[model samples]
Target: MAVHSPTSGPCRSIVVSKLVAPATRRSLENMSRRSGVDLFFSSTLSSAELTDRAAVAVVVPVPHAEDEVMEMVHRIRELAPTILLCGVIDVPDQSLWLFAERNGFNLVSSAGGIGAALSRRLAADDLGVREPIAVLNSSDIAGRLGLLGEFEVEGCSVALWRGGGRLGCLENRCTHSGAKLSEGEVEDGVVTCPRHGSRFDIVSGERVRGPADSDVKHFDVFEREGRVWIVPEP
Candidate 1:
């Protein structure tokens, strides 16, 4: 949602915590603003800059080391001391993702799917809805699953998938034999079940080929209070 206070002019600006080349920044900013959102960078982001405004979403790239990320989180919380809304993207691995979400970053994801992730989270913030749980970033899951690595989403998996280049949550279980879809291959927007080579469309969860006779489940994901959330089955 593009929101602005009368004094703020256009209020749809995000503060990024890492440094990109100026050219890359300009290109990204130009592309994003066309959608009415602006991208601003501050490698050492200050909370004062964040809280001084009414509605702001802070995007931080998760650092590799556990300690570095924790340090960064603590620093931001300390400086902001007011209400803080935090989110993280481009998490390199699951351990780091857990660490970040546990600390303060409620929105977790990989770089490719961040556009939609930010949009969802920011919209939630505007509505004053804070989720009680911190959903896992499927960025690591995207890498693992795309490589035929093994993972199972016991409850719900919010994936900013590699194939569709979109953010969606799907029950990554094989419709037949209940196998984990992450152990199989994803090609042309379809995820395969390793057990018997069953395949389902990643977007619609429709069964494409089988051993699997049924479609996988898809869930809606949204963000608020610094974390992305999976919409539960009704």
Candidate 2:
């Protein structure tokens, strides 16, 4: 949020879990000074620290691999579900926000976009936001099982794919231009964007072709008793 008088501030607490970039670190530190929030930096977070300090949000940078970031999110959720989780990426990829949200993160913004997200979150934060697990049936979809399929999960567009003897679900928007991935072609476990020829792997959510800014999000698909279940987390 913006700067406020100390006496009339919400006095929020946000922790920087792993910020190594100089520019982003400076930007956030300056904002924290002006906003009157208890923003601080720490590499490690114990259960006691989270509970004793009353941290409202945790800022984690996605480095090395996205899987490591996901692990941290799960750990934070287990320690305290009410604390908001924010994931920071290297580039500006607004398209991955849904993917981040679906996987237990409250907000996922690029290095440049984190400020806006933090401002909005601190201004109007929620401690108990959650979505129930969603379910779909194999017989309900009106297409071949191996073809690309679209559905809704936690109010976000999701695409289901069954190919190469493998089954999985993924976010339906391209990270490059926000194009509908369902309109594209899925072959050999890769989804190609119809507009710009960008390709992404449905299984790992990695960008396989360019003109694509970043990779999409993936969800695990479990099939049993003629029904398909898609979990929000991958």
Candidate 3:
């Protein structure tokens, strides 16, 4: 039982099980129409039923049957290791989501929440999600006064400063007026926003001066393998 929807633009191949509630199936069909993704509905997880071109498969397990769900997941993993697996539950259960994640499901969501979750996943992929990025070499930073540099990672403009052998990374945009902090001046470990003179402690990401009441967003950074690495904010 495969149901096709009207699609547009670049489409992603998706296989969904018909065992889900009718409302869930309708929601997925509507989501496919709006998102321009292809959908294939099946009654089971059998290899003969699933299309080889499918990139993702949404499985709906029977309610309150944890063991049966795990068995199906195992069977699917063994049959199609390349396809990303997602589990949809009729009821919202936190423990079930955790179990699915631990048992190899890439995503787990409530039946009604599946559309929104899948849409977010697609949008994240479109934006080219960012992870940890190397900013500079540890040798490039000097002791005491430290070093200051600007970088663009994962579509975010950021400023990196090192002081007293400690490194700090913050978004370049000022909290007050969207000014570029990289254009500001740094003194005694505090960076003054060039536009409104708002001051912030780079090391602590704390706003020490007025006009910018909020603290700048801080990013995790560490020195590893003689290089400074920045873990982009999720």
All candidates' TM-scores? 0.43, 0.47, 0.47
Q: What RMSD does each model have against the real structure?
A: 11.8, 8.9, 11.6
Error of 3 at 123 (Å): 3.4
Residue-level lDDT tens digits of model 3 in 90-152: 776777666565444656777777777776775665523234577787687746353368898
Off by over 4 Å in 1: 1-12, 20-31, 81-91, 127-234
lDDT of each: 0.54, 0.65, 0.67
Worst 10 residues of 1 by lDDT: 144-153
Native-referenced Cα lDDT, model 1: 0.54
Native-to-model Cα distance after best TM-score fit, residue 14 in candidate 3, in Å: 1.3
Which residue runs of candidate 2 sit more than 4 Å off their true CA positions? 1-11, 64-66, 92-98, 126-234
Model 3 TM-score is 0.47
lDDT of 1 by residue, 26-48 (tens): 43454466567655566557654
Question: Candidate 2 lDDT, tens digit per residue, 1-234?
Answer: 333222234454677765546655666676676666666566676665454334666787754445665577668755655556777776655545544554457677766667666876776644323322446676775355555468888778988886544565778888988898888887877778899999887766778899987889876555545666665641
Worst 10 residues of 3 by lDDT: 1-10
